[model samples]
Target chain A: MSTTAVVTGLGVVSPNGLGIKDFWAATKSGKSGIGRITRFDPSPYPARLAGEIPGFVAEDHLPNRLLPQTDRMTQLALVAADWALADAGVTPAELPEFDMGVVTASHSGGFEFGQGELKKLWSLGSQHVSAYQSFAWFYAVNSGQISIRNGMKGPSGVVVSDQAGGLDAIAQARRQIRKGTALIVSGGVEAPVCPWGWVAQLAGNRLSTSDEPARAYLPFDAEACGHVPGEGGAILVLEAAEAARRRGAKVYGEIAGYGATIDPRPGSGGEPGLRRALETALADAGVRPGEVDVVFADAAAIPELDRAEADAINAVFGPGGVPVTAPKTMTGRLYSGAAPLDLASAFLAMADGLIPPTVNTEPSPEYGLDLVTAQPRPAEIRTALVLARGQGGFNSALVVRAAD
Target chain B: MATKEFTLDDLKRILREGAGADESVDLDGDILDTDFEELGYESLALLETGGRIEREFGITLDDDVLTDARTPRALIAAVNALLGAGAAA
Candidate 1:
């Protein structure tokens, strides 16, 4: 068999919780983190609510030196990477730097950092801008910074498919592992809650304007509106199964399979890419539709997107064939961080035998999904599929199975 | 010639604000001749420090001059040279 890629460690920074322990606890209990935006004044904006990670003082998690040089997104990612490496019990000094790699996803590269520099350039003179802005605002800086910090000299790259980028980056890491790299640090973390980022997201026209926290980001609901944008995400450590077994590391699950596709041009008489992405992932994993224990849905929360996702699920696994959950309803859609967070939650669910609830959604029966909502459900979940779609027609699917 | 001399104290302050000292290093020591890299300030940090110095002193240092000044003493000398030349001009 080809080298199997397995997840050995997870580090989460979510609106509901900072690490895996608190995040999983809150997720399984159906606690919602969506609230009024406190990072900046949202009174001027239509969509005023978001899932911001509360009480996160970057200085508490990182050294003061990094504070001036990094943006919030990079700082959060660096912390997540540290936590993941510590959780895996792997020391960079002990491992061969050439055997390790990093692959992460990013949607918007340091919007707040760029905006701040731009403000200085416009108000003051060009000379007032900080030189750090050159690299801080680049999308690939997360991967570069993590690689430099860990001394990982192996294959490294960043994916930019928006929300789908999370899975795409993980899948890329898995590919590297299969190609003989011993370990890869993968996943994404995003912090786009600043004024500049909010305006950019507002341009998408897919954010909930509802001021009520509980009802704002209802996905797959009769009153479905739109997703609430959020900050933070999860970072995971992926290692080759053989290497993990040799080290006697605790394996969370295997990154069994992944598939992605792009929708055709709007005027093209072609089908949407979600169904194909699902079918391809199932085939890639050598898994039948019936074997999947649960699905962590994309849950865009828009009526048309929800219907399309529901239709795709029905066509693939049959209506109500498998239980579906949108745990993101609690933390809001994390953009590049969304799918990886779902992947992490899937592993946690498998370990605990509890499917986390999709909070605040009264799944409209029209979707034909056995939607898990309002409360956590106990199940024998050995296999899971995670789905994510990005704006302007990007679709990705990943299947993770419990490792023996 | 210049209004006031740019002392080692000013360089220390700028260095701390620009890149911050490494946890193991001390900024208050008598180490004016120490290499910037050993003191935990890399090229980028020095570049930022140079920018601040230019803005604060109202005198621009050449990019080459900044890159060549790898120690606190060298950087201080470079800034003082620019200040004297600006005053003369």
Candidate 2:
């Protein structure tokens, strides 16, 4: 009797769209959310473009009590959690508060809030800083606040691994469900589109400096430059298989398997680490390479890294044997929130039987993989392989299969 | 750079911004007599409003004013004194 964990609900706060309906429409239409940075003036900055969520006034979503205390990431997380519970048809009155939990992934939490307070301290002295800065800036603050806000008091935790943290958080959610928790709120949120965030990213040397929006952030092209950093996230509800069935909930899919690996120099060392992660995920899911219907490539836009990932797919699945896509091309990369967004799209693809198009991208033939581009492709998507790689060599893969 | 000196109107505007001010109370009358709690201010609202004023005026405000001062009249006096001290300095 295997107790599988199923994705019962999803809430998304993305630059592409706010709620699941809009997100699906935008994703299906391959809408481009990238635009000039507006939160702060980017005239002095080299990296000019971003996937900003416009007109998102925080006060509209949060209570007055939670507003002053929350950072942008936590605020996004809270609203997404509310929507997820609603979509799951979960009423707190129906279940014991201690049976549920929350785990969120964020590589950098409240960078926008912390940077503002730090500026105030330096220029105006410490007295001008908000008292909320202390608890709000910590990465784990999302997990803490979401759990408290909804009374999800089961075992909870936070993942700090880079972009892969998103899938890792969901993986942890599944493990928690198997360990006797009835339900878990699992996903990632990032709001790093701030002045300080841009400045910090400039130091990474991987940012796209193209002034033209259409010409920038190409992931697998002959003229592929670096990626445009973007902000957005998705939160999903993971429920135990039996519990979800008992409630007659509409399950989106199963989080069948998750695998993560550390690669110091994947491109250099025959990149066996990424292959191992993919192989482990397939094995864990009890799936064959032929069973995977589509592949969500990391699409980092770094030439060598992208090629390494392409090569990794060729080694494992035999030269782009499966249809692959990089939907992050539309939203840039959401960092810690990136992979869960991919997972959400994967689930939607399975449910709708149509894989969303990889916007603003056309992969070159040298990649040897069948990259879906320009438009959405209708397919029998049974199993999806979503991949993510963080800045410092964190590689992860998650396999999501359609629920019966 | 010194910002423009604020007026009573500016003070009211800041207080109004801090407030939902949805209640049927007189927002134009002497706010000193009017309770901020009636205008949707919690304990942190005054401090946040005070912070905004200090930044707008490029002046240093006494931190204690956030806790000790409860009325708009008291905050206005404090702001004027800080602006005067800043100009004098």
Candidate 3:
């Protein structure tokens, strides 16, 4: 049985919005969600701005029993998973337990939770620590929690490749479905807004210190400095195409192809792997450069990374050949959550026939690409390629095509 | 100075503060005889509650406190036994 993976539902917990309706609206209109960090006093940090989800109280959406055991990220993931399953019209009680599984990406695992516990351990003693800390701080907590909550006992896993892990997790879910899992909940959601997570992010020196929200994160522009970090992301429901059709599930798009590569050691003088990863994904999807309607760039917002990405796009699609956009400019880079959100936006674009804009960026002419900025463009987007690169040379590419 | 006794009221407050009561389970009604699990306080919840009790009351609870005291009344008795022992010392 040749199984194909298709996206049946999308759950978004974005800095700009809590659900798909709001997220898509904000994306389409190019509204910025970036603002001063209110989760903590940012005065202690160099980069003060971030994209944070507004008005999300866990108690409103989850059970009281779950509050103490879960971190904020896990709470968000559980809610997103619930929304995605509901959007896909999936009732876990009705489905076979072993047929469904969960695959998710986590970059910083329960940092805020760990930070709180560590404070107690230092000030009070080890006996003061909560026993829940043992599993809550694990990177696989999201996947485990989601699986446990839904009673999904099938093949489940968590990918931890930093930013690239989102696409990688979705691809892993696709792989699992192809191997016989009927349905999988996949993608990434992150909440690294606390003081410890902030200091850790600042250590990378890749965060833009710009205080102005509109100009904080500018990818593919001359004024580009560093990317803005943000919280929240997207979760997706992926099902085997035949099973979805049999159940009469609404299809968003097909997860056509995936490719991943790691860049060479910094001083090794080897070429960057972003171009090869994109090419490999296109080949895997049997898509030519001309067939791809749009490219969702990694958009590192650093000069060298931007140059490499532009060169990769230009190398494969040719200069000014395809329209490139970084819709993340509106929501800030969500670390492991970024690419999956872009994937969600791609599916939405195909459905709406409107390409979301990469707001607030004036593309540098040197890139020689047709960059979409400041406004949404109407187009028949059948195939979209999403790219992501992690901190330590992890590069991943995924291709999605409108459902047949 | 006399050590304050650990009571059912204190356990009720800690249960609510540490893990929160289940919506269906009432913390106010006579719950002293109810099992911690029946009150929606699982092992982890009890562990957290014990941690809070230790901090607020300045007492060291044995790790098996939850295992030994399955009900609210038993937990309070165990805590007061420790308090009475400390006062005598």
Candidate 4:
């Protein structure tokens, strides 16, 4: 609506891959990151599988100064932030302190940190509790630490509304850019694969308990049981499109428009809010249903939720018109990190001219949408619509135009 | 009424343990000038320590005690002062 804000740089730390290059390669190859839950002991629970990042060493990316100050979630965000800034070709010293900012989306702030402190309290008693628990576990820690580390005093905020927050964050970041901020580091990450995080997710009762890692999170499939929770997220560098051009930065794609609404809970027919979000996003993008070349679906994997989303897409793009893909089948649902990673995937898809497959998904008659499955498809993608819904009643849609 | 005093070592232990089980902390640093933030002590650590102090001395420590008692020496002083005041009342 204001100065065009494009995702100029991207950094991803996902289960299937470490960075954008590796992630997209694994995504196109249809590799699965799901495995028996090793982050914590999942033996007690039926859902023992997760899409966890393999062999993530914190010392590799983060500095020694941040070692004591961060939780695993914050560390991942910080590392991704570094990669994003580097990818954007903007060094910290060049930017004005008040011009750059950070906004992060999160579902669970630091369950793993809290879990460790809780263990100390229960086992070793009060004297052994760690002070780091206070800073590390809060939901907004990533934003605070990132801002502090980057010296960005610009207007910033954190959204804890749920997974839909990822898209919402981009929407908010674009607003900041439009309001005259030069660069905003936005996106999200989660490290909820730990025992406490897993137990909390287990209480939600939506995870796939299947022993098979490959098919654990097949969104839009008749055999879809439920989603596997995963780790990692992408931190994106959103800059004014013109500024990126002036700086000769590589523009991934512009976030044309975004829409956000509430679920209004169980009994609502037509799921009007979701439909409205998608329609609003398309309209804001100045893009018609036909103009939307591809869609990155929320892919809830819960039959009714998945159907609701498909029906929403059908209502907007017409049934089977827009090619839909849920590449999350490989990495599982990263909660607040999911849609942003999907947005990252959309950026890659727009750049590479390929729609990555939804790993193990096989489209059935149940969902009347063109679900990209099995293998990557070569296509000319222009405008891509990304959809997301939070467990706590938040529905959001974002539209991205191809970089070319 | 009897007032209890905490040793400098005990206060140092609280500050060290508050940082969690990781890197080293400055235990023998300047008390008046050094803030808790220098010790990598965030608000959560202060809150945990405040609770522990309350439980240990059986006296209620206000949340602002950390900001007020920034260093190990000052913290021990704050604990004894709070305990003395509690015994008086």
Candidate 5:
């Protein structure tokens, strides 16, 4: 028998807000974090709008002496990790360092620090560059920094498979717990607002260039174009159900099932790989299709991609249409942090028995999915399926059940 | 441009701006003793300030320079050494 992995504590540092309270309030109110870029000058780029985290002072959370050694992505992760640890009431001094681990996901690594270092190396000599630049911009920097700060000496790793990697990290953490690790801090954080990262994303033809924030990302709508990029999202604190129960921890939800599939050819409309992923996840969770209460879709906002997702949901839930929504439209896309945030939102929604609205969606009956829009709907949500697909062809789905 | 000597006040002012310190704080005396958390400066802000200083003065600072130069007076001396190195080059 497999050990169930339950989310004992939750923390978020997203564009929506800093902590779970603020994030939940803002998300329920249908607020959009997308706005003009403040991190760097976007004069040259085609897309000017993004879901940048506002008023994040890293020093408020990190210590004074260790500030120079960590990157912005790491700083964000540390903040969220601290909150999760506190919420779980597990202090570093109280717990055994060997039992706790950290697994994080990053899509673009540390773009801001990397951009700064590259600029310095180009204009000035190599000797002028700070030594901290060597490790700050790497994808694994967040996991490394978090582990070092909290004295978490257990297994630490990073996933680099883009948006899908967030959900994959949670799945990996669940595996860790079953393998005898006590706790796992699993999530993702992204800081891709730098000019170079934006330029790289522009080449993908999936970025929405709409000047208006409301109209920027409209998934499943006829006016769909593409997704807007965002920064700063994370959720942490997962433990074995038995271990958490022994510790008298507050269980948020259970990571019941996880399934992932890749379409060899992306953007072809050739096959619905998402259907297989959804079906496989339900089978893994031992739940039937009719038992799924809600779905958190990928909602890429490209016309073809949206249609594929819509078709997948219809095929899974049948013609009755399951209540589906995509909150990514509000925060743009967090890349590595996208699905973890989605999973967190799903867990909260199931716990609270409320379905969050899909922001900025027009009324369209043709899509065939019941999209909750404009207002929160009360529902007895027991199970939620969170879906995410990366830029190239990576597709991931996770099934989370409410802890009774 | 001729090698310009950076005064203690100049370095303090740059650090204060980079750290997002309040305007009321004494640039010369308060900056040296100010903690990183109190000044709202993190790794990214420090790098940005360091980059700006290197570009403006045409000088490169080593890791030891940042570690050793905690006070405004010490930073000014390090800047002077870098400026001297640039002049010799």
Candidate 6:
């Protein structure tokens, strides 16, 4: 029999708010964090609004000396990891270093820092560039930084599958636990607020060019144009169920199943990758589609992507529709941070017995999906399906069950 | 050229502008002792202030400088020292 991996602790530094309490409060209230860009001038860009993390100070959470060497994304990851470690009550000094590991995803790796370094080199000279620039911008900086800071010496790794990387990171952590790793810190953090990062995102053609925050990105709605980019996200501590029980730790939820699929021909719309991922996850969880109480959708906010997700959900649940919510609409899209935040929200929803509303949603009756909107809804949710699709055609689904 | 001597008022003006504080703030007051909530200067604002100071003074502030130079007076003193050293070099 395979061992179960359960979520023991959760930490979030989202656009909604930093830490779990603030994030949950803002999310449950259906407050949108999207606003005008404050990090840089967005006057020249087509898109204006973004879900930027407000009042974040890297030095407050990290050592002042280390601030210049690390990227904003790594700093966010470190802060979230600190919260998760404290929440889990597992000090790195107490645990066997080899037993704990880190698995994180970063869609945009140290973009702000990389851009800064490039500017320094361009404007000044090569001598003015800092040496830390080489590694700070790498995709694995989050995992590396978390491991080094927390003294985690186990299998540290990173996933780069865009948005799906967040879910995949948690799923991979679950696998590590089953394979004898004692603890896994998994999730994602993205800080791509620099001018260069914004330009790179504009090339993707998925960003909403709208001026108003309310109508910026509306998934499954007729007015849906595209997604608004954002920063920060959530991180989770996943421990083996037996280990958690031994320690008398609180179990948030059980990682019942995870499924991932990739379509090489992205945007072709030939294969139903979302359906395959969802079906596989449900099958792995040993739960029928009808047993799912709620679903946290990807909510891409693109017409075709939204339709694909709606069709996938309808096909699985027999068109009767399950209560679907996309909280990402409230925080634009945090790239790699999107899925983990969804997972965190899913865990909280199951724990609180409520479904959070999808903000800024003007539901289309033709979509045939029960999109939760306006206000939070109370429900007896024991199981949830969290879904995400990456820009380059990666799809991931995770099934979480309430701890008994 | 030797380091430029700045009056308390000049230091205050620089702090207000560098820290992104409103003009109404008192320059002679205890800005550093003020809590973040009271001052309304967030982390981003501090970073921006640090960058502006570095560019304006043409000196790289060590971590110690940032930590110890909490008030406008202390920060100005530190800047003067760095400028003096630069002139000596």
lDDT of 4 by residue, A185-236 (tens): 9999999978788878888889898988876777888987888989898999
TM-score rank order: 1, 3, 4, 2, 5, 6
In angstroms, the error of model 4 at A349 is 1.3
> How far does residue A201 in candidate 2 sit from its true spot (Å)?
1.3
lDDT tens digits, residue span A325-381, model 3: 999998899988999899999999999999999999999999887888989999999
Task: Provide the TM-score of chain B versus the true chain B for each model in turn.
Answer: 0.91, 0.76, 0.95, 0.72, 0.67, 0.62
DockQ of all candidate complexes: 0.69, 0.11, 0.60, 0.18, 0.08, 0.04
lDDT of each: 0.92, 0.84, 0.92, 0.84, 0.82, 0.86
Q: Candidate 5: which docking quality band?
A: incorrect
Which 10 residues in a row give candidate 1 chain A its minimum summed lDDT? A59-68
- Can you tell me which runs of candidate 3 are displaced by over 4 Å? B1-3
Pairs with backbone N, CA or C atoms under 3 Å apart (clashes), candidate 5 = none
lDDT string for model 2 (A1-404, tens) is: 56899999898888888888888889988997888998889999989999887767778877655776677888888988888889999986568988999988988778988998899899988767876676789999999998987888898999998798998899999989989999999999999888888878888888999977767888878778999888888999999989999999999999988889988564485453677788889899999999999999889888887888898888888986999998888888899888988988998888788989887776888888888998999999989999988888888899999987
TM-score of each: 0.98, 0.84, 0.96, 0.85, 0.83, 0.82
Instruction: State the lDDT at B62 in candidate 1.
Output: 88
- Report the lDDT tens digits of candidate 5 across residue range B1-89: 57788875676566654444543454445555565435555555566557657766867777667666555556677789888887877
Best by DockQ: 1
Lowest lDDT 10-mer window, candidate 5 chain A? Answer: A62-71
Interface RMSD of each: 1.2, 4.5, 1.6, 5.7, 6.9, 10.2
Please give, for residues A1-404, the per-residue lDDT of candidate 6 as tens digits: 99899999999999988999999999999988899999999999999899999989886777543565688889899999999888888888998999999999989899888998899889986645655676789999999989988899998899999999999998889889999998999999998988989999999999999999999999999999999999999999999999999999989989998899986575575866889999999999999988899999999999988988998899999664699999998898998999999999998898888899998889887788998998999999999999989987899999999999
Q: Candidate 6: where are CA atoms >4 Å away?
A: A264-269, B1-89
Model 5's alpha-carbon lDDT is 0.82
For every candidate, what share of the true interface contacts is present?
0.53, 0.03, 0.59, 0.22, 0.00, 0.00
lDDT of 5 by residue, A1-404 (tens): 98999998777888888898898888878888888888898877899899999989988777754565566777888898889888887787678998999998889998787888789788976745655677888998998888988898888899888888898888888889889889999899888888888998898888988889999888888788888999878767999899889989888889989888887574575686788888889899998988999999888888878878888888889754689988877898999998888887887787778888889878456778889888988999999999988776787889999999
